[model samples]
Target: MPPRTPAAGSRLMQIGEAAERIGLSIRTIRHYEEAGLIVPSARSEGGFRLYTEPDLERLAVVKRMKPLGFTLDEMRDLLAVLDALATADDEERRTLLDRLGMFHAAAATRVAALRDQLAVAEEFAGTLRARLDHHGSCTT
Candidate 1:
């Protein structure tokens, strides 16, 4: 037989494998699909979502952005804007940049919110530790 193509050697992953590979629940993957963050390139013969490496990479982006406080809608919007810019002509670059500015502003806002939450959580943790230490001294 002739040499096999990479595509033949590495077929698309099923929903379960995709989830496991990305350390996300299958439901989470489905939810991302619903949110338009990731779309499977195709379906398997059994009608299961067939995720390729690009899909997995996309999920990685989604995962990274989420813990950093990006909403699914934001992620979706960002990706859509990126795809548009990437496919746009030079004349359209300016327009795309203007759109990208909106996403950047939103991301900045979310990051600020996360930072505030972190500050509050750190303060609360310190207070709790102080209380625990005080109780320990009283009980000793």
Candidate 2:
């Protein structure tokens, strides 16, 4: 097995460094806050948002979900499910797994829809290429 990467240190990092670590712009992080995906652990004396290790991990989850076409609400629901799982007893763990299965089914539906849309786009591109080739022949 590969060695584990150290989690972000528990100390608060300035927004720039945290953003760099997470591969997002500070503005995007702020937008995520506005969207209710993450809340900073605390504010500095200067009133800047201060993030801790948990926040960084949460941001990583958000980043992963966004590219997978999860809406902010879906991401929040998934996070809530994960958070509940973390604190769950053995019986609750079973419930959480059931809930997660539902979430996965919904995500798969979304992925299928996206795939259909992409196939349409590919077909359009092929038609466009044929049209361009025909026009090129006429121009020549």
Candidate 3:
């Protein structure tokens, strides 16, 4: 199959296309914009949000954050930390690195919580399978 095409003229992608590429919904992208986590690279003449490669990169960061159960405010804070790293002085960069470290710790905690939840879910599924095997039937 041929590679997908970008929007005509400019290389920017429309919001729907961007969401599809990132495995997210347009509503989620809009929410991220509202949360000040990311902004569209441009708006088309028809008033649609258009995204560039850098914009997609930002979206990808937010996407990763979501599965880790990061709050919107935490997401915003992390985005600020990332933005500041670009032009921060050494001392400021050190501070940002500290902030980034905090986020990493939080992610680790969340991942552990998710693992516990998954274990419970799998145990429940196994019990159900045992019941099904005992009866050789699946009613309700």
Using TM-score as the measure, the top candidate is 3
Cand. 2 TM to true fold: 0.75
Q: Which ten residues in a row have the lowest lDDT in candidate 2?
A: 1-10
Better of 2 and 3 by lDDT: 3
The candidates, ranked best first by TM-score, are 3, 1, 2
Scored by CA lDDT, what does every candidate get? 0.80, 0.84, 0.85
Best by lDDT: 3
> Which residue pairs collide in model 1, if any?
none
Candidate 1: RMSD over Cα atoms? 5.6
Task: State in Å the error of residue 90, model 2.
Answer: 0.7
lDDT over C-alpha atoms for residue 60 of model 1: 88
Residues 61-100, candidate 3: write the lDDT tens digits: 8999898989888988898888789999999999999999
TM-score of each: 0.78, 0.75, 0.85
- Tell me the tens digit of each residue's lDDT in model 2 across 49-137: 88777788999999987866888888888888888898899999999999899888977887888899999999999999999999999
Q: What are the per-model numbers of colliding residue pairs?
A: 0, 0, 0
Please give, for residues 1-140, the per-residue lDDT of candidate 1 as tens digits.
11112365456778999999999999999888877788787776888888878678878878878877777778887777776786898878888899899877877887899899999999999999999999999998
